[model samples]
Target: MFSTLNWFGWALLSALFAALTAIFAKLGVAQINSDLATLIRTAIVFVLLCLYVAGTRQWSNPLALSGHSWLFLGLSGLATGASWLCYFRALQLGNAAQVAPIDKFSLVLVVIFAVLFLGERPSLREWCGIALIAGGVMVLAFKEQG
Candidate 1:
């Protein structure tokens, strides 16, 4: 059923949710410590994902996963936790408008990593898009002092 949707469609949904996450997280962290807020948010995500897997009857698949999958998934989880910690702290200290765009500068890094590690070949147009994203990040992250 999901085969009809391409990567761009799924990525668009991810981007939309990411934008909402920053807004909600900023509001949530306003009265609390950002680290505590991230903990709560992570707990919520953990429960929701558990429920999703159980509801989908996907519980049995984990045992079938290879060692490599487990290792990489664990690393990914660690990366996510670190990112959330930093992101929440950044949001606490800065405007969401400024912080979110800078956070998304990861896109430029993703393009480079994909090429270097994944051995994926991107076309000239994709490289240009990555450059544009980098430029936009620089423009957005720059603050002019009066």
Candidate 2:
């Protein structure tokens, strides 16, 4: 099942797991500090990835990676950590439905950032979809006053 899977398949699986992460994290953080919850979640991810890499015989020397690879990956790791911390804190205080949609606002940012930093271009159609996602997130994030 995994052999023929492509990026979309992997992305779908990631989305499923991310949904579960919101539900689980909301419950897990109910009695614990959000920071500590993030720590535990990060540790689990670290261990799981380590084991998966080793089991798949994909381990490579850190020294073998290029400076560019190391720099970008390090920056990505820092951003992921910060995102997780904020996400967990938000989930702790907000409804999962609201928080998750707001968290997914990153998708809109990704498109803009990719165009600006990575020189990727999106078509008019793609921009329309991104705009819809942004609109949806805004709708989910803002509640009407009584």
Work out the TM-score per prediction: 0.92, 0.97
Q: Highest lDDT: which candidate?
A: 2
- Model 1's TM-score against the true structure: 0.92
Backbone clash numbers for all candidates listed: 0, 0
Cα lDDT tens digits, model 2, 58-134, are 99999999999999999999999999999999999999999999999999999999999999999999999999999
Worst 10 residues of 2 by lDDT: 136-145
CA error at residue 29 for candidate 2, angstroms: 0.3
Q: Each prediction's Cα lDDT score?
A: 0.93, 0.96
- Alpha-carbon shift of residue 134 in model 2 (angstroms): 0.6
Model 2, TM vs. native: 0.97
Q: What is the lDDT of residue 52 in candidate 2?
A: 97
Show the colliding residue pairs in model 1: none
